[model samples]
Target: MDDSTVDRLAAELYQVSQTGKPVAHLTKRYPDITIDDAYAIQLAGRKLREADGRKGVGAKIGLTSVVMQQLFNVYEPDYGYIMDDMVVMENEPVKMSEHFVPRVEAEIAFLLKKPLEGPGISVADVLRATEGIMPCLEIIDTRYEAGTMKVEDSIADIASIGKVVLGGALTSAKEIDLRYTGLVFEKNGEIISTAAGAAVLGHPAASVAWLANKLASYGVSLRKGDLIISGSLIAACSVEAGDAVRATFDRLGSVSARFK
Candidate 1:
């Protein structure tokens, strides 16, 4: 697709997101759209938000887990930009009505102490650059119709990121083995999912490394102080209004949010 067409599609998707209304699959309408074109649409959408004063804070890695990849029928990971306004505090009330179709997942969030730019970034390099890790809840809201979205559609939709809740605890990467870190996800006081950090691409740090390298392909770099949310450790669960969600990590403590 050409730049004008990409811009128009991006604006359409962004309008759908803002209005909490679902739209038809972009790939179905534009069968010739490539992954690169989808990413360009995503960037164009980000520019739209940036023009409205939303600053990019960091990035989020998606589909790093086999479960999610299988769910999405995709083989590789994808990423999306994180805007500052998308963040919510732990235990804050989230307005569920603001989303079209929102789901929640448990994750480990990394706060960078040094910039990471990679063509050859490794797990060790990610650890060395780390500031700390915190438990987080990623709320994913899709703007596309159900079962109609392809990988390219997801990339264009900014990985369906809606909101993020960061936990209060921040533990150094060297202090614990992230691969072995366990998480118990609870909704309305009952356990709904449980997983280990290794569920995210063998190790949460590995996901960050993957993201750094992936972003490099687009001429982007992970900057210092970026809050990177590694792929979810557990499968995402559907959420509704009046629901209370929580995720307890073995070492990183817990994070919670209430939807209303």
Candidate 2:
């Protein structure tokens, strides 16, 4: 695709994301479309990047949940960038108008004290590189209308990231057996589901390792202070207005967010 072709698709994508309209994935129409091609179009829709206007602090994992795998019909997870502006304190209410068809998921977030870059990164590397871990809520909304997305289309849509909420700070990554750290998700005082730090590709840190290597392929690197959201422990729930969501980890405390 030419520069104009990429830009045109991106612009259309951004319009729908910001306006809460929907779009169909071009790949579904043209199965021959490569992920690279899809990215060109999706990045062209860079409305979120423009709105936040902050440096990319980290990345988030998508399609990691078994439920999402079933929903999206893919086994591997996709990724998106997280900006400084998207980071907010947990337990606060977010306006509903901010996202287009937004949904929520529970995750374990890690603040990296050291950088991890690699063609061959390991799980131990992720554990040693972290400053600490915390509970996080991931907000997912599409840039296009409800449509099937190719890898590149999702990437260009900035990995379909909408917003993030962080809470329940831990003293250190080593404080708990992060891989087995288990918890339940509750909404409005009812137990909705469960997830463990282990559910995230074995450990949340491993997700960071995956992010680091994945970004390196595109000439990006993980930097110090990057708040990496490993992957969802539980399923992505269809969020509605007035819903109060919280995740309570076994050893760690709880983090909550409300939609308004």
TM-score of each: 0.96, 0.87
Residue-level lDDT of model 1, residues 111-185, one tens digit each, is 999999988999999999999999999999888887667888989999889999999988988979999999999
Candidate 2 Cα lDDT to native: 0.76
lDDT string, candidate 2, 164-196, tens digits: 988857657776888788889998889999867
Extract clashing residue pairs from model 1.
Answer: none
| RMSD to true structure for each model, in Å | 1.3, 2.6
Query: Candidate 2 clashing pairs?
Result: 10-44, 10-45, 22-145, 23-144, 23-145
Q: Candidate 1, 169: how far from true, in Å?
A: 1.6
Clash number by candidate, in order: 0, 5
Model 2 regions more than 4 Å off: 17-20, 28-30, 41-52, 65-75, 147-152
